[model samples]
Target chain A: MSSPPRDAPGAGVLRAAFAVARKELGESFRDRQTLLYTFVLPLCMYPAMFWIMVQGVLVVQGQKQARDVTVGVVATAETAEAARGQLALDEEGRGRIEVVALDPETPRDADAIAELIEGEEADALLFLPDGRSEDDPAALFFDSTSSQSETARGRVVSALEGWTEELRAEAAEARELDPEVLEPILIQTRKINPSKDDGALVLSLLLPILLVVMCVLGAFFPAVDLTAGEKERQTAETTLLLPIPRLGLHLGKIFAVCATSMIAATLNLLALGLSAGHLLGQLAGLGDGAPKVELPLGALISIAPLAALFAFFVSAVLTGVASLAASFKEGQALLGPVQMLFMLPAMATNLPGMELTATTAWIPVVNVSLAFRGLLVGSASAGPLLLCAFSLTVAALFAIWFSVRLLSSEEVSLSSETISMTRILRILRPR
Target chain B: MTDPTNTSAIRAEGLAKTFHDPQRGVVEAVKGVDLDCRKGEIFGLLGPNGAGKTTTLRMLSTILAPTAGRALIDGVDVAEDPLEVRRRLGFLSGSTGLYPRLTGRETLRYFGRLHGLEGERLEAAIARAFDAFDLHAFGDGRCEALSTGQKQRVSIARAVLHDPPVLILDEPTTGLDIMASSDMIQFIESRREAGTCVLFSTHILSEAERLCDRIGIVYDGRMLAAGSLDELRAMTGKEWLEEIFRELVQRADAGEGAA
Candidate 1:
């Protein structure tokens, strides 16, 4: 077999870099488990996990709606009968309380009545006289800490409303006054909460954390494989022997990890979509009716840039840190801190009152988290979000430059010998 | 300065490297080494561990920069133009490995591309390597699955994929069985026949004796001697190569000049 002339070789830096990236992507997908981690897990696992969670919450809520609470009356038997009769008039069962009578001769001791509630004999105790005129209404008391007690109080209020209506009617007949004149004004209100409001709070809490965390996680394995894995396999020097620049080599590796990250995150987004159906199904139990839980399409589309930028940001960091280690296990250990670095900032976004402020927009991982959350909620301002993007770009550039510098130097890359601090300082200080 | 002609495939003069370890202060890894290997010849560097055999090869292959002095690869200065030096060179070591996730064929293609070979030419080059190394049967298998000998062949194939004029192999047979070692010797001889200079290090004395057109004995990061087998024996006044090697190491350890 004859060999070709050595005078010329095909393609240059960009092409070579891409070749390296292609090889990495191909190799990653070939291993079934790696592919699963990269694609399948995010697509299937999160949805199933979220479905189970939603089911659990719905069951607990359903039990609460059907619960019955006992109401203990501190008044005489006739007073309790009047309240029961008033409650019985309403057929909707809006009053979910069971009535129990007390002795009329007993002192109206609020403390003794409270004892019944404290001892768990009754959920709540109501205090009222056996008889009272329309102008002198009975007073009612119940424990606030217990949900049962709270429910009983609501039922007592409903019963009082009925007695008040009858007294007003009698007074209106005697005076020959219009019955509607008793109420001079009407009040109306609107609320935006999880039950009646859209799932804005959940969206705010989950979006950015998932975006940043999944982006980091997506880059994790690929970054490790390319850096420390190369060394452990004894292929680092061999790979570097090519004519391509160290920059090309690093860019190739960073590109591959970033691509994997985006792929993983996008799959994670799809998983979020699948699990969203179940999440919305639980909202229906609120009886306020929930529109389908649609992740703002704009937010989903915007993630492409944020996820890519984030992938670029963290992949460079992960690769550079991974390169510091000599083996896969050691790399994994070293990267524990790197993962924490990303996670802490992302988790900070979930804190209430934490917003995309001017200062926070320049805070790397934290900025991306805030900006991403804002984007999802359609509340992120353009100025701060762009600033956050710029900050991430700078960070990504620095990490890649650092990685390339480490890779380029013969003292470090060749024998896996790290430069001594004094040597590095000498280069830095340049005395 | 050992080059006798302009066609020297490798040349070196006073190559020096010193590493600073805090506890040990200055650790001189290589001290002013000078040597040369002519085209179509095999040069063997024989020494024990930490004797600078690897350090010297790394310098010549442009993997490490010299603290002082310089070397040339097939006429390209290693220090002044390291990329040019790397282009004309094929480097391998006992520690160097093939990608376990890639097949032998893919390994050849990747290195070929890195070396700037592509298209039909790259295919031809890979095919030539597969045929020359007799690696067809194991070409499709991932590198990790191949036997040690097969892996070694693929490693060598990848190294010379660009048809470099110079080959630098450090302890090429450090962990090979007898069969694999012989196969490596045959491959090295073939490269010499093809007019490519082969510089290698080995622990196997008989194989070195059989393969080297000339041998350089390095000890304590210094070149103690360089000559043909008969010439080495004559200089040391020893009957056997091992005796000469032992005498040289002892002399170097004793901090004495050549006898």
Candidate 2:
């Protein structure tokens, strides 16, 4: 009898690895928990969260606008008329201010003003001496403890400032001078990259942290399931008995985990991208003038390689760390702290002046975050970006190597040995 | 080097394993033990719990490496070329679990692919496994939804999917009902008839007596005596296998006490 044809050595190993990955992905898709975490949550969570936030802000703003306040104007009859006109209502007519004339004999003192405020006769008191010069500042008093008083104080101060500006302009016109000459320094801001999308800026600031978190989360469950879950289910021995190399099996699991992480990140980015413009508009009160939140497809495409490498690195690290555990719950306990390690570094991008640089490009999660931000904002340089990618590649390769070694150990694969720092250190050390 | 002419499908020489625990210091789980099983033979490993039967079988199946001596699966050195040895051997334990999310058919296909079977050949093997295990009734259902007996059948199908020459089953009938246990025994007998070398461990003396062509009794990680039922009875001058086992264990204990 003739024997079947055999694949070349490398081809056979690769085929087995691919088969393992395919099986894992199939199982993951079938698992309801994995599906919920990987796809549905990311798709719905950002939009729902943003919607709730936008609605909350709008509700609070509406409530604040609908409130009205009374202000006592302790001013001369002539100035009182001007104050009435100035403080009648806010520009949108949403904030109404009732201007009441105080008794002419009323004392112009803090105690008297406090008495009027406390008596509920007025929410705020504005005192303007009859004979005060134009240069004399107006005294406005209101109780900070009361929201009405705070609102009245804001209206009166705003009206008085407008009144002062008008008075200054009149004074300047009477002196035969142009009001514009009063301000010599007019700061006009300009952007070097005017084409930089507002959406991209928001994404740059926001996506990095979200990407790191989502990527970690995406890899988290699968890594635990494939390793510790397998052990707990007593399937680890079955997998270990396969004729393939341990490295192949490890690689297959990592590939499946990386795919899930990337899918989650992409879905999160898509959800955030779709909703960020409208959400930011509502939150910033820009309304109709909100900048269109266009995803920087170019930057996204460019950063794909880095994102993939980061996912691979995270998957490998999670897989190896989780494998130390003998049960699914134990894996979660071990990985929960490890997640903070990735998250805190990604958050470093939110710090002001934090950017991708020679030093930062070597840092793991921070480098990827800053790089993603820079790429989106059109600020990334090729040299540092390349360095960052190289560093991640090396780290990812190292993580894969370490994970394969860990999986290859019989004690780890077969025994429910108590995890220890010494054992971990031993694994980390070269054999 | 292994002799190609040797009929032994499973062979071990002084196979041993030791574990290092932080609190317990050094502990030897399997002291030097030796065994041989020829093709078309059923060798039963009889031992009490914690007697190192599982550990020994693990070494021969290439799941755990032997810390001392050597093991060979179908003439392939276990430690030297574990992957090749694995290809020649099918290993199953009571605890060998199936993927809960995968259907039985999918699980078979996965194992088949891992064993380098694919395309038409893979499908053919999977079909045959499904038929052989009477799994068609529930093959499409997720393993998590299957009954215990059904899952065991699927696990057995998975082990034998690669058509390996040497089969190492560690307490295959453990946790099974009377009917399931009988089915498992019948399957082991079938494998022996098909010229597959079967080495299984069981603490159930009745099972060893009923199914094993040659029984090797193990105690405290040491093999006490190995022979056919008649040879063992004659050696111990006992009529029943249970009495023979007790006599052998008592003698080993006496020897240890004297030492």
Candidate 1 residue lDDT tens string, B1-259: 2133577788899999997665678889999999889888899998888888888998888767899997988777888767677778899876548888889998888878767676997999899998988999999899989888888999989888888888999999878888887888898999988899999987678978999999999888889999999999988889788999998888878888452
Q: Write one digit per residue (lDDT tens) for candidate 2, span A135-164.
A: 655678888988889888877777778877
Global lDDT scores for all candidate models: 0.77, 0.84
CA lDDT for candidate 2: 0.84
TM-score of model 2 (first chain only): 0.85
Give the B-chain TM-score of model 1. Answer: 0.94
For model 1, the stretches where C-alpha displacement exceeds 4 angstroms are A1-12, A31-34, A68-75, A79-120, A123-185, A190-202, A283-289, A409-431, B1-5, B22-25
What is the per-residue lDDT of model 1 for residues A1-431, given as tens digits with 9 covering 90 to 100? 13334443323557657877888888777666557777878877777777787788777666665567676666666767876666545445243667777665545567876787788877766667645747534666677887777777776687678778898888888999888787667677765544312554456577678878888888888887888778778887777776765566778888888888888877887678556645765755544365446655677787577667878888888887777666778777878888988999899778878898889988888888888778766688888878888888888888777666655555445435434556444433423
TM-score of 2: 0.92
